[model samples]
Target chain A: MDVLTTPLTAFSQYFSKSDYVLALPMILLTVFALGILMIDLMLPEEWKRLNALTALIGLGFSAAAVFRIHSLLGPEVSCIPGFFGTVVMDRFAVYFFYLFLVGAAVAVLMSVKYLEIERENHGEYYALILFSVIGMMAMACGYDIIMLFIGLELMALSTYVLVGFLRRDQRSNEAALKYLILGAFSSGIFAYGLSLFYGLTGSTNLGTIAQGLEKRISANPNDPVVIFALLAVSTGLLFKIAAVPFHQWAPDAYEGAPTAITGFMSVAVKSAAWALLLRMFLFGFYPLRALYVPMLIFVALATLTGGNLAAITQTNTKRLLAYSSIAHVGYMLLGLIASDGTSNTTGIKGIMFYLLVYTFMNLGAFAVIASLRRREIIGDDLDDLAGLYKKAPVEAVLMLIFLLSLAGIPPLAGFYGKYFIFLSLVETGHFALAGIAVLYAVVGLYYYLKMANAMFMREETTAEPVKSSPSMSLALAICAIGTIGIGLFPNVFIELVNWSMSGANAATIAQLMH
Target chain B: MMPVATTFFFYFLSIIAVVSAIVVITRKSPVHSALALITTLLSLAGLYLMLYAPFVAAVQIVLYAGGIMVLFLFVIMLVNLEKAQLEERFNKQWQVALIAVLTLGALLIFIFEKGRSVFPQTVTNFPENTNTQVIGLLLYRDYLMPFELASLLLLVAIVGAVVMAKKRV
Candidate 1:
């Protein structure tokens, strides 16, 4: 009895309040998710909307927890390792946590009306959204490979279901199946790579792995195992970001998923992947920067070319945006490639800023499409947008703002996003890459304007005005304000990104610079 | 450098695993294919045992051979087999599959060739009887976060299956 009690006490002592405090946001979300599932079982059909309200409250509370952690940690503490260092409390994680929660909240707001229209309103929908956001938060904060993998799977599995939520639609079924098979395959490759690293380092803790990797690299500067692991891991991550040659699933999945979910996936899911990529490279595998930078350049060039070239012929609105998102991935990758192993934090900061802006603008664009969804019309075709200006003047103007911002026009957040990337590229003296990226940006504008032209110039295809619920309008308004606000006051958002970069990993990045 | 018995058992398990795995894909009958899969799984478990990972081998046997096999057989039995057999066995997509396989094979070979130089590091051996205890401690202590997250992941999987398969939600 004494021995048993001793072990139990020792185990209980291992987890202090700080552990739970750092993980509070994710913990709160999980609780709310479980609560929603339990509540859904008892709630009547008419009251299903309460789940959405519950989810919003959960997000709000989680956000408050994030800010609480921020205030508690203050600006001086770089990061605090929590849960035995499997996760970390850091400004970087806090920043992305806010981004994910905000993206998720707006997604929920946009989803209510869309789900109601599709006659697919259910509590599970909101629960799944919350669950996926939990996964994204984990990805943002995870400090170990195992935690990252589990987090990635959680997010992937939820989205796979969400993508095919419309069970009656055949296209949705096909897209879900495709995404599932491909995503699972990539995850397997990713695990193999991480296992190789574990074998090489004899540890899963990223800090320990970094030390081990440095030793391995110094001993055998050209270790093939390191290259193989890098390639395998990057393949998996690039697939998630929908980069070139691995992006085939994105267009189909985007076209097939519920419009509101498409918004969530494009914004929150992609940003989560970018966060993971930055963490893995800048922290665990920084010693191999010389080996990976060339690889990123080629992939970025191909992604830009393939994504823009492919988008030119797309008639469907969702598929076109999917390609455009792929192109944006290309630009961000260029930012990554421009990261010099010196104290220059511009490249990484550019990616963070770009992702922040992308969340608002892209989700706004998707929300507009979701608003166009009617009972009979699928409302995804470019022709469907004809004379949207006549029917819904306000919505059309908002859509125009989203499109122009996406096209990198001045006075829009998208332009600042591209501007930072270009500035980083030139700062790192990649003038050639900068020139090519600018050319692709011009090409991207063509397709975006194509949609805009149809909206304002063509005749009305349907007599009914675009009907959007108040919640959707709120979502649109949030996105519009965020996109325009960030653009007009770029300095403020830049400061926010700069504050996030001033974390423990910022030290790791600084080490990479020199 | 190695004991003769251990090396022979390693080769024996490898051969069986490869042969059964090949049989799994080549068999025309779904039942036969599933049975071959079980053989493949069991042989892989034996291989794991040879590597001193008894816990993994046990899990492979119980989960893959025992639990999932039952699910596979039940589904196979419920589906109408004769009508499926009469339908097209192969689609025009075989070309794409072939290309993908070739590319993957080429990559594996390339990696294996380059990795040969770094393959001869020391192999750490743990005490045989303490294997389970060590793993349990590591999972519950140092790896607790991932362990709990895995439970949540499985929950998502269950929820996803329900959402995708059920006629109504």
Candidate 2:
């Protein structure tokens, strides 16, 4: 017994408890998704909401794991290397993991009633969302290019199907097909760039890639491969984030998708893509800052104007939100542009805070829109929401909160998100760009106010009262609280965001100097 | 072993690859284009073999030529191409796209020629040994994470195929 146990113990030592904790959220999600699929097969039609309950429980467990791991992360971004350094558990990744969990939970809550209303309530919906979360978790934590690409695919493929879930609806099918084609093309471009990066560095782990890139750049100042890699990777990622020139599919997809799914895409997908972009550039392409910064500046200006100007023309609320989301991507890019590729805490912090605020504000707005949608109504137009104040006072009030926040009015979550980015831009001496962004933001206010006015002033077209479910209300309450909580008590969130980025900035600066 | 033979084969492969690629773009019939693509892929695989990358050659044939080509043809058959052909052959913005592409091509050529010295020109030193053992060891040890992640990607693809393609489910 002693002889047999000795070898087993040796093998077990190769794996550790930290590995389990580092990957806890992804593990919980995958298991629950599979478990739901199995149980869904056995359950009767009346027990459909049971799948939503299981998904919620799964999300809860993952959220609990995130909290447990939260204390382990120090103020300094501590990288707990697991799986041969492919998965780096850091404060930055932890922040996003928490975001993904909260977003998934809200989506689940919204899905329960939304699916029931549409009569397409099934277990697959919950399972696919969980699968997408698993992908997001992977994207957040992955330190290697392969891990990141696979995660991106997992997320994209699942969402593509989720978009076309309503097979009977022609608009949904059209949007899904368009998304799939463009998404796959961008992925190919991304893979080509990644392969070139691998060829030059002879490695895929971002830390080593950065080290290799640093050496290569120092050896030859104008390495053409460096410029090409930047073009390829940035283009691929920009498409995913719905930035300009590559954002054509976003409005159609967002307008056509299930409202909860639209919210999920707006929040979860944006967060994951931005995280990957930060990791790649801040860590991997820091040496070529001069080459990439100008590219980002042009992109930021284009995205800001394109998204806002297009959004102004949209009469459909969902399409308007879609373009608005693109515009928000432009603001977030300002944060990236201001980052000195070193210890620029304000820049990364601003981006992180904005994403967090956005998850709540955007999801809250979408949740209200989902609640309004009925079979006969299909009420996504501005007219449908007319005089919402009279029909559902509470919903109208919640929508107003979201609109004001989005409009960047003071004492709301959205304002702070924009304020931080603007501060960072000003601090970096990009005063002119900051001025332009503010001007566009003012233009953005008009459309948002138009919708707010529709909700408040116009008379209702129909006689019946607007309604909602307990689950939808619960989701809305969480979002409303998140929106107000971060806006009012800025100290706590700012401190946390500052700490999360503390490790990455100092480490990046130190790595370069050596 | 013969320099002349190698040169002749290189030219043969290049002609096949380029010709087939042009056919793939220009052919009106989808099936003909797909078949042309398979030929192009196979010729590229031959070039890989000539470069002493037997393993890559095998994969190019198996995955791209065999697996992906089948999928491409399946999709082409599924769609109604006759109706598609009746529509406009080119986009309204084709002139703009063409100019951008031409400019990009010129810039790429200039960069390659000017920066030729910076780019490493590695000597052809193919290992006499096979790659099977090397890749296997690397996959099992050094690239364990990516290796497993590949499986997860396939699983997602399977799920997507079912969820999107199947009508009854």
Query: Pick by TM-score: which candidate is best?
Result: 1
lDDT of 1 at A42: 92
Docking class of 2: acceptable
Residue A431 displacement (Å), model 1: 1.2
Which regions in candidate 2 have their CA more than 4 angstroms from the true location?
A1-17, A75-77, A219-221, A341-343, A510-514, B1-118, B121-130
The candidates' interface RMSDs, in order, read 1.7, 2.4
**Candidate 1, which segments miss by more than 4 Å at Cα?**
A1-13, A340-342, A504-514, B1-54, B57-65, B72-117, B120-123
Model 1 lDDT tens row, A75-185: 556666677768866778888998899899999999988887788888888889999998888898888899999999999999999999998889888999999999999
Q: Candidate 1 — what's its lDDT?
A: 0.87
**Best candidate according to lDDT:** 1
Model 2 alpha-carbon miss at residue A155, Å: 1.1
TM-score for the A-chain in each candidate structure: 0.96, 0.95
Question: DockQ for each candidate?
Answer: 0.50, 0.33
Give the alpha carbon lDDT tens digit for every residue of A158-265 in model 2.
899888877777888998999999999999999999988887777887877788888888987778787798799999999999999899999999988888999999
Task: Calculate candidate 2's fnat.
Answer: 0.41
